[model samples]
Target chain A: MTARPVLSAPPAIERHTISILVDNEPGVLARVIGLFSGRGYNIESLTVAEVDRDATLSRITIVTTGTPMIIEQIKAQLGRLVPVHRVHDLTMEGPFVERETALVKVAGTGEKRVEALRLADVFKARVVDATITSFVFEITGQGEELDRFIGLMAELGLVGVSRTGVVAMSRGPGGI
Target chain B: MSAATSETSLTGADIVLKALRDQGVEVIFGYPGGAVLPIYDALFQQNDIRHILVRHEQAALHAAEGYARSTGKVGVVLVTSGPGATNAVTGLADALMDSIPIVCLSGQVATHLIGNDAFQECDTTGITRPCTKHNYLVKDVNNLARTLHEAFYVAKNGRPGPVVIDIPKDVQFAEGTYRSPADSMPKSYRPQVKPDLNRVEEAIDLLAKAKRPIFYVGGGVINAGPVASQLLTQFVRMTGYPCTTTLMGLGAFPASDRQWLGMLGMHGTYEANLAMHGCDVMVCIGARFDDRVTGKVSEFSPNSVKIHVDIDPSSINKNVRVDVPIVGDAAHVLEDMIRIWKARGKQPDKAALAQWWEQIEFWRARDCLRYEKTSKVIKPQFALERLRAAISGRDDVFITTEVGQHQMWAAQFLPFDRPNHWMTSGGLGTMGYGLPAAIGAQVAHPDALCIDVAGEASILMNIQEMATALQYRLPVKVFILNNQYMGMVRQWQELLHGGRYSESYSEALPDFVKLADAFGGVGLRATEVGQVDDVINEMISIRRPVIVDMCVDPKENCFPMIPGGRAHNEMLLGPDEKVENATPEDGMVLV
Candidate 1:
């Protein structure tokens, strides 16, 4: 028998979550987006909101994936934006917490309805709204947990889903 | 009235003019439109700042860039809304890529009409966000003075680039309190200029032990001003190291120096590229490792330990990674490197360096720039040679070039002894950049000989600038090597694309002499090789705008070319070249 040779797999593409503090000014967001689009870098998820009202500062959370070299370049390029004050790569730094909220709608009339409700209960999802034949469940958890819940609901007469993109923070008392 | 008096209430227009005066702005290249009328009215009321009206908004910005690159100050431009601001985008991108400091004042629709799509309305700030280093939108007249002052500060500071201030039409007419420079210092944008001493020590240590060291310089050294160039020259001389410069960095180091390897890149000298590829330690001073400079990154100087010195931190490791990265001004870091070398009592290994010099001399002895001289048709290289000879003794000549085969030939033949004397579009490679840049240089130094070395195809891109030169009575010379084709494109097509000529030939070229006459300027053409020198002399003696057309050989291609995507040592030499010792296997030295 001929021996089969084993080949090493290519480097895995790791996901990175980064947080940025920037001056809350007009076109600042456009500038950040431009950096990503102009350089052909991918942004998997993004969430931004003003953090400090007095200081007029905003925090932006971005989730992206790339090779190690590409991730470093993205961080470097992001830090160079004029309005940006600081950038923290949470994935590389240390432990971090991430949360996402998803709304799932299921339509059924009999056993499927009971099965949907049972699955929601197991997944710790709350019924936000209901109709005679449909139920809208609001589930909040880590991205993987949400994905698992959505996959289970798909088998139990799942009709639609609306998800808020990933919003992450460091898992400590320190604030960005 | 001195600007110190706070009791006077100034209109926004007056405030803008006053602030420009306080910033030491003597000239502004601009054009007037409906939305910018108020600013133009203010400009008309003052004799302090002279506004030169350009034929197109793009020319205004390029002229401003030329002025800034030559004068080492912030070039200012003013244009109206919509198409006017849109027209300046190319020049803004060019300035950003080349690191030329420019302050562009773009007029906008009234604050209420911003997103309403009013006549001549556009989102100026949104459009310019990517092109400008920084930008601002002034909705209220109360902030106009402060914003304009800050615009200049941001534009001229560390790693200088173009900054735009979009002011609404209402803001221009409204009343505002004018602020001085001392009052509106930036709060968050302080650039780090000092170098870390430990890193400087590390760099010096590497240089001390380096057997084969080469200094790769770039435009940042020129942008750092004359002192930086002086420090670089001192450091190179003290160490007795050979140096090569990028196309934009041509004049930063004296090209006449024997240790100078010619400009390095796709069309650079064979010695410079080989030295860059084979050096044991490479010290890149103020130049980014552009893809053109470092062809095929995996094979680029694989054995060298690289040290990069730049003012901008992001530029470091953006392309090719380096061992020691010093984020500081070129002058500051070079000063520290010199100091550290002196303190260590270190000197380069002379015997080992002699071996390196022997290799470099072997490459240089190939006569990479040599070309055949024909009596019938004037070669472009010969035309530049005659031009160089004509301006040999004069120290006040400034040369600018549009992009193409002529640009490479000019880079090879021209000798610049000082910084700011050679200006061309390097990063963006924008054609039609030379004419307006020459006009700007001429405007800055009225008595100096400003020549725009152009190709037949490239010059036609901004041929309208001839009127601007004539109106200002600026004695700028447009020297065209009329080769009747986009020679660089044609050469590439011939080499890489199996000689499918397709759209590269410039059909129906204008009668350049008649065109010059129509613009009310002197026009001269040399059809034969013998008449080239006389035509250049007559064009120079006219003391007005003149275009000298030297009909050059159309078949000539720029030689010593490292074909795109090839290693530096994989160069294609020209015809009739006899480097008897070089073998095909030796050409793949780094591969």
Candidate 2:
């Protein structure tokens, strides 16, 4: 029996963004989640939307991290499931753009409030909802930027956060 | 309208009954409640559909599941909303886990009162969402026809599961254009189920790489038919691995094959469980790793790489972890695995494979099934053997079983050379399933001999179906293993549970022969070992519903009990591997 090589992370493991095309209908999302859940595999972030004009199909982008072995399993299993037209492991194929939009709110006063706004501006976060005592910042970009914004706000009185989850795609790609 | 069938204006109930008739649905097991009363009223006018009113809503559903399993038809059940639908939950969930096809129709409390939680208004659609293959909360009365068509479509298609259609009371009573749809829709309703080449290759790689690989088989094999038996045997031979089957997957692997491990879980083979837990790689085919199979889920196959192949998506990770999960039909996937395996020019090492085979054979012999066969008035094995001899291969005969010692004996002793050979309540172990299921089976295959091998106490559950069977002229032969006690319970009392005898005695059975005559069918009692053949022949000669109240030595228990959680090789056969009990000529004795 050939031993499976367990590759070590080069200093740090990276999360690759993935996008998939699947038939849009009832139970489609459940099927996708089921594939992840059945194998004890984890899905870091997920989002699905009915993207086809005729209402017959949808596009789902998921963000997850693992060693190359796990990622291959994920792609292969996803491709084998019914109604899944294609599975594109964007991480392995080429460069890919990953984005997430989150609504972050912080309640504080004085220097803490000032610190929150300062951090939001640096991250290009928009203030969608605001009051004298609180500010709800809408941030759009990579997951790391959102994480940093949330972390700083947590110390400066982060109240609540609503994330639109992750939506990813291959950068200049043939459709998969 | 579906991409296949044309749209019709007939009311949903009209369309449903007509669709069922078109599919050759002979009988329906159901309960009538406020919401579903309208459908029942319409059913009254339809002579083609004979509906059996069960005492409990759950029984209606279970009886339908039994019916489907015994006869291989899409079992039909109808009930009212709220409690009526909820009561059927256990049965539906059982069918879901076992992959039995059942179409559940529950009456909704009218659309206007839906979310308001009106009187007896339950969101059956939501309640059965997870358990059903697909469920519909019918909103458009216009689309009711299509919805009913699709409900059957999903339930019977791909991996066979329960499907519930929540028809509002108004819609059931409403009038519309209804036309019978063809049985051909399930073909396209599901995606092409043929296996993908790469996934099969990966599975083959896992098979080839592992030193100890085990194939876990379940009811999915039954779904694949004769091809499953041959295909799986080929796969087993190719991979040179041992196999374990679920209670429902009994006949998928040939009993005569040494590599075949007996049914796993609760009453599963100890060797199979050990192999499952110890194997480096496990290929689970046509099975969901049920809680029973993986008792302490955390401790189940902890170090093994697992692959799951099933048609249902919910089954993928609902329980055990999967390394490679393939969603497709069993036969198709097996075929693909075979083709791709051959394409790779791979061959299993015969010497090494045969060595693996020897270990399984050792376990099999250690846990061999044997009864103390002597001059017994009725031995469970003798009954099984005689029944096996009597049934003609040219004729299609179906057997249904009630759970307990008798059920286990049937599962183990019956020689089913093929798949879908025996139907019993494997998951729930319900006692009263046999008779009703037999009636339903008779309804499905009108020409077949529908037999329910039941224990005396267990037979009483749904015993009222005897009248229903007679009313329909269904030739259901009920063989009652009259041990004069709750045999399994009594055995536990005798062996493990401190001999409590807690309501295990039979103070309730009437003169069964008189009872049978009373019910308008032939009845006979077997008090002598030599009488078994004649009694069975007379029952067959009667060519109608008959009851054989067999008086077996209640103490002659089904031996070789493998205690729960014990290793397979460890067994509690009769003392010193001997049967020293009193002979059957000793006659009936009161404990």
Interface RMSD of each: 1.6, 6.8
- Give model 1's TM-score for chain A to 2 decimal places: 0.88
Off by over 4 Å in 2: A1-112, A129-134, A141-151, A154-176, B1-8, B17-28, B37-59, B173-192, B196-218, B226-246, B251-328, B333-367, B374-395, B482-541, B551-562, B570-591
TM-score evaluated only on chain B, model 2: 0.82
How would the docking of model 2 be graded? incorrect
lDDT of 2 by residue, A1-176 (tens): 44644755453456767788887756678777866776667789899998886847789998877655566667766764445677787888888778899999899999999988988889889989989999999999988888988888889998899999988776784666
lDDT of 2: 0.75
lDDT of 1 by residue, B1-591 (tens): 465664467877788888899899999999899889999999998799998888888889889988998899999999999999999999999999999999999999888889999999988888888888899999878888888888888898878999999988899989878778877776567677898889999999999899999999999999999999999999998998999999988988888887899999888999999999999899998899987688766678888999999888878888888999998899999999999999999899999899999999999998999999789799999999989999987889989999999999999998887899998998888999999999999999999999999998999989999999999999889999998999998887676556689999999999999999999898999999889889988988999899888899988999888766567877778844433322233233422
Q: What is the DockQ of each candidate?
A: 0.48, 0.08
TM-score winner: 1
Please give the range of 10 consecutive residues that has the lowest summed lDDT in model 1 chain B. B579-588
Task: Record all residue pairs in model 1 with backbone atoms less than 3 Å apart, i.e. clashing.
Answer: none
